[model samples]
Target: MTQQPLEPGQAPAEHPDAVPLYGPRYRENPAEIFSELRRTHGPVVPVLLEGDVFAWLVIGYRELHELMGDPQLFARDSRIWNQWPNIPPDWPLMTFVAYQPSILFGEGPDHQRRVDAMSGALSEVDQFELRARCEEVADALIDGFAGSGEAELMTQYVYSIPVMTVAWMMGISTTEIDGVARDAVAALDGGEGAPAAYGRLAATMQNLLAAKRAEPGPDVTSRMLAHPVALTDEELVPDLLLVALGGQEPTALWIGNTLHLMLTDDRFSLTLSGGRQSVGQALNEVLWENAPVQAGLGRWATRDTQLGGRHIQAGDALLLGLAGANADPYVRPTSGPPANNAHLSFAHGSHGCPHPAPEIAEVIARTAVEVLLDRIPDVILAVPAEELTWRPSFQLRGLLSLPVKFSPVPATRS
Candidate 1:
């Protein structure tokens, strides 16, 4: 059944973490705040996170599962989103490139076509190949810090692998691709290192797209260019840039977050080391427990609809929480504790992130580390957990640094 539109004067639930989007509380402890709402307001609650505009906040996992998949009830478009006051200029550009029009963001036939085009080369066999390549990349990166006994896992390990793999797939030189990916992700929030980095990354993707047009290769960009979908130069360039840039950082962070959580939680650590299925289960736990995208999902109400019993009007921006939904007890009954089910790190429905492949890769990558740790009994945290600095961003989740020490078992005195 399609969800109904929101009605007027249905005030947002009063919660401490319920604040304007610009506030730090929104960035810092969104899940905590949303949890409060879920308890107080039930599954679907009213929210005003984006600005003063009201939209439905889908708190329960089941609601998100239904809402994200049902296009007739909920809609996404760059234009409908622009009406909100205080909307960022780059917001539309980023949304269009990163989410809307992208396969995950598209509705109806356009979504299917775009997905088919890009996914042809990303088959299960291709995914295996990507995993193999990622394994090699992971080896080289981990080796770089092997002798040091301590290294920033995010910069040196987590961030490097996906960017390199994506670049390799795209036929971009690893040297150029890694730096560009790093700079672009750093610039996402338009902060200190953001402006210059964003510019360079943007220019690089634009140039590469042009190059691909003239001489297409086996990469995703080449495939996209060959697709039947009509893509403007404006759309194609920034869109590819957004994909290449946005893809790697979150992946890297999730990997880091998983590792960080595993090392900290005894039960999680034991499960991850159990076996393949155990590791897979543990991976799901990590995704839910430490989801990288801390903020809720973003959407604009197309027209008035009654969702979760609240009245919402057209142009209402719904900032649904991915992490919140996954953790909700209603979604997955709390069996013993909060670690039973896989987290909603990827999201639900047609618009959910197409990251099962990468997520699998991330699990394998982190599990490999666990395997190594088991093999090497002396591996230990070289630095305090508090010393680790996580990347500061409302959109992405990851660590900035993870320094650890390992005392390798002495070479057997043969």
Candidate 2:
């Protein structure tokens, strides 16, 4: 499931100890690999990405925190990467680093503008209404399989909730939400069909933009278009794409991973009797431990700098190892909840997930979990806890599937 060593030789990185960040070893479990990498190479480990492309993973909590705060030293623009020549145009991971005019690569003043506008629009979403909408989405999804007394929650349930909720928030009709959500998840998978899937998403957004521009509504798209910053349709399309993506995939994974934790971990077994609050608690714990986004495209070194005891050269890519940072032994306590919510799950700094985006995601995720538990109180893992397989993705921490069994239940009374 990997490619032959691309380039001059087997060793693609400057550090001799650089290890491939793919293959069976990593797919089995990345925590142990991150631990070993930290132990062997310190906080900043030199690693080879999917195609043996050299990059640095910042695993230390302190180093990652500093990088997020100091964008001057490590910028968001990935076009400065020195290894671009060796990377293929169709590299599966290119969606992360490719130079797009969107907010992902925005810098300084302009980036702040985009962040402000997006945050303003997201803040306008009524939390009460959003939670209600998410509950509806969850209940409808569960109704499809609740009668069978079983379901593979990942694709059937987990992936649909956030995408459908976000798509609805964009004012898409119910009929189109399913198809858009499917294509969006495909795009997020970054697989062979991702380009086409992403193209379809952009086209959908283009159509939405046209509709919103002509006649605005109280939805997210209309709010962004009506923002005083005066974003053109071009700017809105990509920003909307980021909203659909940033809002969908990670949030979906957040719910799925947390559900995985609740079903598999004994600590949460007691909450299965239709508890609602535990959903939020489990969501928080998941953020601290198995952050949905394990890493990011990360910042390019603005100039030669020393960090985590490693001398980094200019233009070197320093990926934010979110799961690694959250698990740093120096910061995380052994037997209790971490002292504070300092985990880098949503990232930090100005470029971090915009102000209200995290809140919106949590609402979507929490309600999805709560509604499912309320409807199917006795859901249990269909497979042994250890038998579940993690998705073969270094970027996202999610399961390939979450098979579960529950008693048959009639649809909601509402």
Which runs of model 2 end up more than 4 angstroms from their true locations? Answer: 1-13
Clashes of 2: 0
Give candidate 1's whole-model lDDT: 0.59
For candidate 1, write residues 98-128 as lDDT tens digits: 3434554567877666555555434422666
**CA RMSD (A), model 2:** 3.3
lDDT of each: 0.59, 0.85
Clashes of each: 15, 0
Score residue 136 of candidate 2 by CA lDDT.
81
Cα-based TM-score, every candidate = 0.79, 0.95
- RMSD of each candidate? 5.3, 3.3
